[model samples]
Target: MTTISQTAGYTDLQTALKVRARNPALDRLRCFLTLVVLLHHSVIAYTYFGHTDPKSWIGFDAIILSTDSFFMATFFFLSGLFIWPSLAHKEPWIFLRDRLLRLGLPLAIAALTIIPIAYYAIALRRAPHISFADFWWTTVTVGPWPSGPVWFISVLLAFDLAASTLHRLSPKLVDPINRLSLRGYERPAVFFVFMLIVTAIVYIPARVYFGASRWFEFGPLSLQSSRVLLYPVYFFIGAGVGAANFDRGLLSADGRLAKSNWAWIIAAMIPYCLLWVLIYMKREILGNPVWLPDWYEIIYGLLFAAFSAAILFAILAYFLRFKRLGSSMLDPMQAAAYGMFLVHDPIVLWLQYWLFDVDMPAIAKALIVFVLTVLLSWGATAALLKIPGATRVL
Candidate 1:
């Protein structure tokens, strides 16, 4: 018979082992990314409420671009990082089932519950005369027109499903992609050139013909198309990194490579920030429609994206190096961040409509909305996590 204290000690040790198995750095990254998403949505809310002109709001515009494209790219990459190992370790059917339960269920819930609320709110505010049936029909058949942020969930589910199918058919295909490397003197330059060409080819045509809005549209029940070909690239990159055991050397305190990695990150940001400023100036000065020439947008967009990715990875690397900061109370908030992402837009829209008549500066109104939305969204997610089905998807 084991003593009670001994059993308690064994349980504690088991818990510690379980946590050590998972990546704390990834948890921190998730938390930071959630804040990025929050900031992005806050700025968009400000724009929606006519607090600032879309053209002139340089900081806000930069945040929007970085958040919309870069963060999602990173998310996919991180997802891919974890996914390949899990897939390689588990049976195919089990992996598929888990993906469906995790990705598919959330998507179904978003479409059925969250999106309908968005449409209802919009209809009430913008077109009150429209019946609920009309709103429902439009959302179901046409879309919530401009779909909410949860659009990422649906799109990612598609990617996962596709990747899983391919993996099942040809597990060998991923092996080569997983093995791609930059071994030569000019490899980094070659990689950059390849990325540039790919970005131009994908984004240029899409921007020139389809327009920016159309490129990101969520077509009813069929596809969520976008000019962002780099999402798949990021996912595969994550998979490759996992396959190669690419740990963040700089993230460790005693690591020798820290300084060089930090320098690379900072150097990357200079071009990114400059590109953002240039794009902001062009948009503000020219007052051109959002759908401008693909060439310029593609070039600048890629530059900004590279910068964003570098900065994000660097920040994570640095934080991971200093273990003291990793144990913050805010860590759980990161886990709750995805849930907040799914729900924040509807909350923002409702709050904006409710406060439309309030006498306040546009910035003040925006701040209020941001604070309230973050609190409410975080709380909603926290509560949902306690419920079994909600946690299953969330």
Candidate 2:
């Protein structure tokens, strides 16, 4: 008995629901995080200890310290959101197909192309006579092949495949987490505690054993040895939150999280300062030992986990508070964020390489490089997206 008009109306409602499901706040946050990624890379060549350039900046160390701590974890968490819904909406094969195209394609391309180009700039510094072609060939064939920032894409693809398998086996496996998320709508602190505890449990022991600087790599596939489990913990937590009632769940803009973002920010700073204390302990007390003791790593890992968890909450709470206010400035760059992430490494490195001998303060060089990188990366992404059907993948 359904009339054609009624059917069309129902379909429109479905479309509207789909639109509503996309969280603009998180989109803007992700875009902002992409810029943070840029800043992290842009400033590293200028940091005091890693002063490859003639000039070095102390302030960049503080910037690097903060960004290196929380940005990747935040990326994983943001990525995990909407995955469950993606699984729920698509067939297993379709989900895999889309993920491979979206995540895997870019990863494969970046590994062979973008990453090599980025690192070649560094290779030029080490051996000014080395050609990019030779450097890239040796890197890929012999050893120390790096994936660079695209490691996230590969890891994300793995998480996506795992999620699809879990969805097939039992969609309800995450039901308990979904339940917890419902409670989180009213008290986001509960979710914050959950995230902190889980990350700490997974991160501390591994960090103590492997050390923070240790990375496990085979070819272009690489990740921090200490954080293998930590990333997935955040992803699954995000999955659980998005399993049902997204707006009514943990990230609810109208909920307690947004209402009291200042508290979460305060919570974030305590552990952040604690991390600096541990740094001081390492340098001043331990005399910058070549090898840190297990006790030191354990304490450092605890502070790292706590700071990461708190900052995740703080960032989300701030965004949720502004979610419905109006059009975000980030909207323009949102589509370009992924492209910016994929392509920025080479841009920053090449810029830094060009600025290597420039007679300027470290801060000035960093500012110039950072600004140009942002502009060029954004322009490159915008141009690429204009190609025939490029939007389908990049």
Candidate 3:
């Protein structure tokens, strides 16, 4: 009996290790991406191009540009990874209920309260005498309700409903995508090319017509017009890839994606450089035209799509390659990452508001904001999770 107990203990330990081995890396990646989101917002007011605040820096412009180019779309891709397995296991109503609780609740809370408070900083700067209550009420009732980063949650819920319908219509709809994913094990570039083409085709026309800087903002629903179709494409592709035999697909440790990490790095750099060239052309050659020609938008849009795809490929490849390594800093922070994302925006904005009067360079101010935002966001998330049943949704 003692010997059998020892065998059972060993079996449990092995089971635990096997479970953690595959999941930790992806969890770490999500945490890191959340931090990136914080950093992106912290630096935005200081970017030379935006110049909303006193401090301005060209480096911040580059940071914001690069980040905006890929982060949201990549987020959709990451969010898609577990959808297939989730749908396969849960009843449709059960899944819908969970999504509503997890996604809808947060979005509603953020849009109604947190987002208003965050944007209140901007409003105060614009009109110092306006009371918070008045601003909040008018904002909520009248017009221009900014969703901020919580926009992703609302959009994701929509995608989940759409994907649910597709699954119900034909469970085998993703079979071809799974086959495409199988090819990625040896030739990951095939998947990369397919993603690039689809996004470019879907995105370029919308970008050219609507132009960049325009968002369909009405109440809590808002998204970049160009990315509406593009984001869904990436999400659906991710679902298809994860639909079957996930471990043997592109994310597999032994796949060409892991082996070609350096190649993907090079791939990411080329389009990034191309984007800068186009920027130079816009500033110098086009004389910074307010109304850009369709040809320029088409070319720039195509390059943007390529850059976006390559960077995602580069990030995924690098992560896959190092997934077998020991634990990372992101491991300890993983639990709070989602909460951090939900809360960080307001923290960063408030900090910026307080610091606006201080004498400091853009880089220094941005650094301080990023550091404080991270610590405060993490602490807030931890504290919130201690509430009875808060952890279930948060």
27 Cα displacement, candidate 2 (Å): 1.0
The Cα local distance difference test for each model comes to 0.56, 0.79, 0.79
Q: In model 1, how large is the Cα lDDT of residue 290?
A: 64
lDDT of 3 by residue, 294-383 (tens): 999999999899989998888888777557788787777867777888888789889999999998999999999999999999999999
> What is the alpha-carbon lDDT of model 2 when measured against the actual structure?
0.79
Candidate 1 lDDT by residue in tens digits, 277-308: 76666668757566566666666655655564
Worst 10 residues of 3 by lDDT: 1-10
Residue pairs with backbone overlap in model 3: none
Angstrom error of the Cα, residue 183, model 2: value is: 1.0
How far does residue 76 in candidate 3 sit from its true spot (Å)?
0.4
Task: Score every model by TM-score.
Answer: 0.78, 0.94, 0.93
lDDT of 3: 0.79
